[model samples]
Target chain A: MMSLRSFRDPVLVALSLVALWQVLHHIAGDSAITAPAPTLTHLWEMIGQARFLPHLRETGLAFLQALAIACGGGILIGVVLGGHRLTGEVAEPILVGLYSVPKITLYPVILLLFGLGMPAKVAFGALHGIIPVVLFTMNAVRNVNRTYLRTGRTMRLAPMQTAWFILIPATLPEIFTGLRIGFSLTLLGTMLGELFASQRGLGFLLMTAIELNDVKTILAIAVLISAFAVLCNAALLAVDTRLHRGAAPETSGK
Target chain B: MKKATWIRTVFLVGALGALEVACRSGAIPATMVTAPSAMVTTLVKTMQSDEIGGHIEQTLSAVAIAMALSITGGFAIGFILNWFPVLRRAFAPFLAAYYAIPHFAFYPLLIVIFGLGSTPLIVLATLFAMVAMIVATMTGLDRVPRVLLKTARIHRLSLLDEIWRVRLPAAAPHLLSGLKLAVAYSFIGVIAGEFILSTSGIGHEIAFAYDNFDNPRMYALILFVLAIVTAFNMTVYAYERRLMRRRGI
Candidate 1:
């Protein structure tokens, strides 16, 4: 007799999870693998606390730097590859080869080359996350109407001229999509790097909390990080939507 | 042309060889960086070692299991969501936010909550990859030719039968593409998890090498990983291509 509206709400999901926790704990009692579900009051109390701000700034800076590097590198490479047919064809396979390799394996190499610092984290983030941007940008640029290019050539448009006036407008949607993924994965890479081996950043803080077994502090940091992630995601989506608002109807085909 | 292909291949080989030479000349200031032959030797030795084998097994199992579970779950959710497009419409923003957020950023929390072995890795992989799979599957279903569906109706196939035999078949390429992407995505997730959080895996080894500035070991491991991925891609491509050619897909 439950309302259909209650079927899949996040609230309902949380409730169900909590109930399952209670049931399991009641049956198996307590163990290292299981922690009794904390009441909402615990979460609220952590939210009400301070000292999580500096850690937030540390993670945010890394996230931002990583995003910038990935977006910049990916877009430049993507556009260059997309601009010329020969480069596109040659770069296509190499880029895929680079992309297909387990980037996680590159972490040690990146750290070795760049050393254990923000630069290493930034470079790792860019390498891990930039592949999607390159792929999508290449796709967007490649899909430019051949007729449009021919016409531009007939009109004596310089290569840059064509790129600025027509290609960017036509390819903005896909480029934005690529950037969005690029930024998200950049954040992921930076966090992973920090978590695995670092002296600073939100991930380092989280790891420290884990080692200390301070459940309240660990959950608080997590909540803050998740909230940051969600905010960054929303901002990226907004940028993506805004960039393509000029030409939406054309891409309804996709 | 064949000549162009050969040139590209030659250039790539030459560049890689040059990179090895640079490493050997000690021009890069990283002693761990070395020639391709050295990397090959390292890889060969590591593979022959039992500890390396165990590391590969641990990393591979996490990836394999996480991938299997995520694919099944993604496909199921995708099928259902596509069946009811209203759900997608209602939750597209939430979906965007979910995928947008660095799910890895939450891994530390997961490690805290789940106390990592494989559970957190699996959850993160499934969560990260399923969104793409579901979106792909839904898009595939959304593209089913209206005329074809009408024609099937005219032929009096049951609704359920049409879905099982026709719609699913029509969406096969997209679903497979989703699976292809999920392959890399899930592997990325598990590797990241193992690297950051676990003590026994390729990731852990990679992290150790990075910390120690063992550049040669790191490059060898990268080559080893790249080989595994290439093998996986070739197999999937061959299978998918053969399947497509058979079905006229």
Candidate 2:
């Protein structure tokens, strides 16, 4: 019923957008670029060709690899910093310092050092993905239950054992949240790297389409990118829900 | 705790400095890895040349104007959306879905429609940032407590008074969070815009440096951007702190 009502609400805006697109299509018809439908169709046709998959694979593989490295590195660093109060406090400001800087500025360095290949892209993506991962990991570690810690100590558990058995479980949920953010950023970083210089990748395709003024292909690829992002987000969210359910206390009612 | 903090700080800083030194002076080629000292020289040159300042100013001007415009626009739309649930039900999903849409892809379309430079850049930033404010304001207003509203209605309080005394203040925190996120989005939009096709701007500087393989110059720009962003973040942090203090938040 909610979806049905939602559908009823936007008919006018939808109609108006299409109408404006068509008007712009005809009135500014001086160049082939004026209309959106043809470009949209170009986007569609690009998908039907066999050439699309390679770039997608190249981009996705590089992104996934970078994300894994970043996740591990970020969480490890974050855990060490965030485990203690003063260190966490001091490190928080420093993280914020680095986070604000646009990572795109490092593209030249990455390309020069890593040689314009998937390695460069992966490194760039890892840098992009790591900051948030570190931030959230710190938060997760700081938020471990102190009372639980006292109980574990009372039971004569070794420090490492307590951390492994106690803190890790509690940190899982927030760590997952960080991973989600990091994963998205990894994609953005990889795409940006590819755009700067790549023999093969989605970013390369996007640039190619734009430079060629092939609006349709750009739109088609864009659709694929958006679909991929949504799919990734949904996948992360599913994992998050599962983790949340598993982490919940076995008993609820008094 | 203080000892831990000091240890971590010393370790991280020392590690970074060591790594930088290794990358710069070790077996790695100078062409491959620009030294920190070299990067500093590059930054100094860019500053002396006043080339990057113009670009920074251009980017900041767009971000400031776009953010201000969106704040007003978002507040208005959010209020209106709250006033009419019919509109809310209609537009909310579309807005939510598009929020995640990279829209960076359609950036070229923006260029097609609006041409090169500030118009497309500023407009895109505004559009991207505005949605959050609208959603935040709408949700905040919708969740206004029932009894106070009932009492106001029973007392026949004017709509203006009810909104000012009740809704606005109550919704302040959410609105501020929305505004903060909007600022981040605006920053992203400006950079992405410049990265894609702008003739000038900080993003253009990075792209050009990369194209030319000017590693030190690129590193300089990145550090400069980091400093600027850190400054922006402090401003927002201060603003948020002041608001919280004022509101007893």
Best by lDDT: 2
lDDT of 2 at A8: 72
Question: In model 2 chain A, where is the ten-residue run with the lowest total lDDT?
Answer: A245-254
Task: Please give each candidate's TM-score.
Answer: 0.83, 0.76
The residue pairs in collision within model 1 are B32-B216
Regions of candidate 1 where Cα sits further than 4 Å from its true position: A1-54, A149-165, A238-254, B1-7, B30-32, B99-120, B212-215, B242-249
Task: Give the Cα error of residue A137 in candidate 1, in Å.
Answer: 1.6
Off by over 4 Å in 2: A1-45, A147-173, A234-254, B1-41, B50-54, B74-100, B128-181, B242-249
TM-score of chain B of each: 0.88, 0.80
The alpha-carbon deviation from the true structure for residue A219 of candidate 2, after best TM-score superposition, in angstroms, is 0.7
Candidate 2 C-alpha error for residue A162, in Å: 7.5
Give residue B154's lDDT in candidate 1 (0 to 100): 90
- Tens digits of per-residue lDDT, candidate 1, A1-254, equal 33354235534544665577567546544332134335235556654657555656676777777778788888888888887777788777677667756677777767667877788887887777789899999899888777777988999999899978878788988988988777666776777777767888777876786676555555555555555666676677767877777666666554
Docking class of 2: acceptable
lDDT of 2 at A254: 11
Task: Using TM-score, give the best candidate's number.
Answer: 1
